[model samples]
Target: MKTDLKLNVLSVGNTSTGSRSLPSQFAEPIRPDLVKRAVEAIQGNTRQQHGSKKEAGQRHSAKLSRRRRDYKTSYGHGISRVPRKILTKRGTHFSWVGAVAPGCVGGRRAHPPKPIKIWAKKINDTERRKAIRSALAATLVKTLVAQRGHHVPPQYPFLLENKFEAIAKTRDVIEALEKLGFNDELNRSSEKILHAGRARRRGRGTRRKKGPLFVVSNTCSLIHAVQNIPGVDVVPVHQLNVSLLAPGAHIGRLTLFTEGAIERLEKEKLFMQEYKNLHPPVPPAPQSPASHSKLQNPSNTQKQSQPTQQKTQQPSALQPQKKVSPTKAPSTKSKPASQMTLTQLTK
Candidate 1:
């Protein structure tokens, strides 16, 4: 008789068992009702923390005022005087204190101050603990034995692998995990986890000494796309912090799938960057005539052409001056001859 007994080989926060396969115990039949109940129980057990008391209610209070008139009447003429029927009238035995109105000095208070309303919602201890455990158990059971291209039983289901860790900022960590066959199909929301938290001192500088961590999100974006094997967390490894990576912080053991995915992502990223650097964008061939002109007429070319133009202008000006001087010489000679002829005629 082939009997199916459940085995617990994978321990959370423990070292890798180095075994590639499940211990055959997780292959037992699944109970959908049990899983549903577990999900409900886990959800019901979640605890939401409350804010500060001062922030819970409005601080400034509204002010209120009150005034009242006395019913008893006092009699008076143009001159001050007490009426005969007044409480303080002559021969009246009533006390003056009793006749005083409420809210007056030594009188009873009309309205006392009121307290403002304040309330808060809180979670119970038992429910919170139960929820955490149930969620973990559910994740563990589904990830261990499920297979790709096969119907995943609730007790032993596998998830398909695709772009589960695509959104991680650290490509190195994400690609490393993808190379390992440990992704699972859990229908929940997915998210990219960032690295932030307390640091622990290692040998030299401060480091996240808590070992490693895996983050499973409640996002459904990559749930069914990846081979739903149970071990891959879509989150990057470098983003985790010491507090989150501490012993007992995560739900299961840290596997090489995560490490391998990160490595692959790093390599791919490097290769892409190298390819981009090696094949830089070629500048567009100078299309504008203005740019071409600027390049061809560099400083030396401009200086050479300017000197030649100046030399041509200088020769032209000199030739015109030389022709004008010769014509002026002939005019001077003709003027002297005309003056001599006039002198001889007068003699």
Candidate 2:
């Protein structure tokens, strides 16, 4: 079945100039599992490697002896066997405290984060490509978009005319967005709030709602114009990824595509292979004996019919049939793997 999915291309004035068919990527199956994995993999790759210093909290020269009657001996001291630091001594009695243990003060952590530890999660190339296609498909889904807390326009899957890329001023970009019925969304994203808890002190002082993403064919003046707007991001179609489209492993983001970007997607055939598999070609039906006889000559008909009979009989003889054991019955319970959803599997 062919999908006649199309998006209306709006001009700068929010007037519908024309409609164009959506690319095959938009028709890809919504595999939330792949999308989440791709997003996580991208995030993991960007994480900075961090670890505690090797000699941190372990430079103390203090030592304790376990041998009895030995100087600074911790054994038979009426205290637990542990490394101790001596403070003051009088005769055979000495004042000391435990050290170098995780439970003790100024001690090394039991399992500190190591810089050598791998943080990046590997994803198959095909899976990553499928994920990008899934994320792109989610953008066209109204339910998914709304679930992501985006204020969408009445006409979903918004597409813009090529002229939008010519916008050079931030004011013009805001005005164009307002005229396109995005005033509510613009206002929503503009309301920034102070981050809760320690996040504010950790450099993420303010947080704002994610607004519509502008996807263009190439670098243009509009990129500068829209970037200044709160929560608005301008990304070229070639650089599109699951993380950008489905932030925080959540599927669906309000996206605006330029006419040129849509054309480029079709021309490049990105994610076309995955899309083709979603709709496989149906196999031809088997021909009946009457129809088969009509297609063949009278003399050859007997020969063809004999082979067809033999072919059907051969499968029964060649194929091994399993003996049903009366003692055992097939399990009705579904396998955990088969029962798991994409989100659960990804997690």
Candidate 3:
């Protein structure tokens, strides 16, 4: 079945036993947008919420008096508006030290994180599934896997046989991985880094490099074998998620699939939407008669006919409107010289 497929099933001894065709999910187009969204949503959903204690900084009774003789009051005292409690008193005077206010020695924070605040993000089901498919396709691309900093072998993106899943010893698993050309990859991930100076102070001291992923059909001995390996992960096919597929929201992680896992993926159709649950087609609305449709609403029919009726009722251009005759004004100074009489002109 490997006719056009470039994938091969590798035995525990690192020999190609047969070829296997990739599922349609592997042919999905790579979409970084969807992948990033899904990964971020997962990260946000996994975030733990924390906040300051309820009684923090409010444990002390720092109330002060406003009387003239009271030293606790800031009435005559040349002190700031900060609330202070009398720690030590002597006769008529008292020691009023600042506390219970912001900027004081031990005061409540202006704003603190609230444990009730939601930190999770949500994405559509179809979008999340598409993102997973995209990530799966990204795994097969040699350029992407290499770009993700994995030590890719000559036969990159090959699947392991079901027999490989039976090995329970970590040493045997390492030997098999080394034979499959992952020795350098394993060595690279094994080395740890101790952050220096400020980075260490920020709790980032020890770090391990991310390594290749192993995907299998179910919980098997392989899962426990790789548990001791740094950055090496083995997840069952059904439990696959965006975070596992593309760690840190970056596309493409070196992934090894077991032959049984791929077959299970095809059988279960993981992450793909099911068609049986879709809504049944609604029966087509019965066609109504043209006359009845036009008369469905009297208001609409009136509104449409009003304009056409006005156009038809308008008089034709052949009959022109009569012009209003202008009335003559009293003669006096308004009359022109030619129209005025000879005696009137002399006057």
- Give one digit per residue, the lDDT tens place, for model 3 in 39-74: 999999999999999779878888877777665567
* Model 2 score (lDDT): 0.85
Q: Judging by TM-score against the true structure, name the best candidate.
A: 2
The best candidate by lDDT is 3
Worst 10 residues of 1 by lDDT: 59-68
Look at candidate 2 and tell me the lDDT of residue 180.
90
For model 1, residues 1-347, the per-residue Cα lDDT tens digits are: 11243222222222233323222222323334333444444343453444434322222221111222323322221222221222242442322322122323333334432233223323443333233333333334434312212223332322222233343334433343333322222211132233444322333332221211244323333324332323233344323321221122322223222323333333433212122343579897756987677788797446655444444545665465654544443344344555677666676
Whichever of 2 and 3 has more TM-score, that candidate is: 2
* Per-residue alpha-carbon lDDT of candidate 2 for residues 1-347, written as tens digits (9 for 90 to 100): 22479888899998888888887778888999888889889999999899999887677655878898797687876788767777789997888877777788998888999999888889987888889888898899998898889888888776899999999999999998889989989999999789779898899989888899999999999998987899899998877888888888898899999999988888777655533343479999999988888787576545544433343444477689888878878888765897889987887
Better of 1 and 3 by lDDT: 3
RMSD of 3: 11.7
Which residue ranges in model 1 land beyond 4 Å of their true spot?
1-120, 143-169, 181-347
